[model samples]
Target: MAGYKFFMFDPDNGFETYKTAEEAKAAADEAIDYYRGDAGDGWPDEVAQVCWGEIKQETQQVGLRPRDEEDKSSCEMICDYQLTDI
Candidate 1:
């Protein structure tokens, strides 16, 4: 399951691993749904406009992913990962 690094950049903060692009998208979807449930269809947009005066996403910029075949910048090299107990 080796692959090139996937960097997740937060506009308000530093970079971190998004695990995969799909995971990043799923996280965004969940956030939007939760906010919409609490507010309305335009929940996220409305909140952003009121708070920051614009619309923004949680996952801001996605960094460059190297070519997998070349095995450049491995995911492990980019992200801090460890196991945890339940």
Candidate 2:
């Protein structure tokens, strides 16, 4: 089935597809939280904080498009998680 795709601006990341927009948004929110120091350990040191700070900036900026839509900056692929896999 076709999916909804969202572009995550993290340099190491790319377009990700989900079965629904809610799922995509939830995933993005989780990543945003992690980047904001929601990780259990938080930022360990200044260098680590500084490095991930850049990612935190970009992670807040996201773009969404339908699966069939064309986006020159990224490509899409489904990454759905199955219930059984949970």
Candidate 3:
């Protein structure tokens, strides 16, 4: 199937994407859990708080903007998860 892009926002980071909404949301939750130390040895409260704040701001910003229909090859929304810490 042809790939479609979805936009997702990360608090600490900026914009991102996933092939599907489910994939993007799963990634976001995983990131939150990981940062919060659900897996153990989580990030410091200060760091986590800052990161989360950034993500929340970004999400809101993107949500307020108009959707881009020109980018058919990419998801319309952004993915807010990262494999590495920012």
Candidate 4:
């Protein structure tokens, strides 16, 4: 697990990838805040927190797509990035 891994997150499109888990994690925290209906600079609301809770039950991987996106290309892309090791 110490070797580099690839992750995709959005604040931008196209090249939205992370080289480290910590980077992906920051994006996940931001996503939780966004879902929590925070101004993203303010406290989280109950509904948003509940949304976070639900997604948490789904997966711990920060920048991964939803569980339903099981396309082979998506899996390939993650692997492709890992292989590239940029």
> Considering every candidate listed, which one attains the maximal TM-score?
3
- Candidate 4: tens digits of C-alpha lDDT, residues 1-86: 22335443434222234556576666566665555565566654432322111111111333444334555464433421122222
Residue-by-residue lDDT tens digits, candidate 2, 1-86: 12333333332244455555566666566556556673566743332322111111122223444455554444564233322211
Find the candidate with the highest lDDT and give its number. Answer: 3
TM agreement with the true structure for every prediction = 0.32, 0.33, 0.35, 0.31
lDDT of 4 at 45: 49
Ranking by TM-score: 3, 2, 1, 4
Model 1 lDDT per residue over 61-83, tens place: 34444446556654633333343
User: By TM-score, how accurate is candidate 4?
Assistant: 0.31
Global lDDT of model 2:
0.41
In model 1, the runs with Cα more than 4 Å from the true position are 1-16, 41-86
Candidate 2 vs candidate 4, lDDT winner: 4
Instruction: State each model's C-alpha RMSD to the native.
Output: 14.8, 15.0, 14.3, 13.0
Question: lDDT of each model, Cα atoms only?
Answer: 0.41, 0.41, 0.48, 0.41
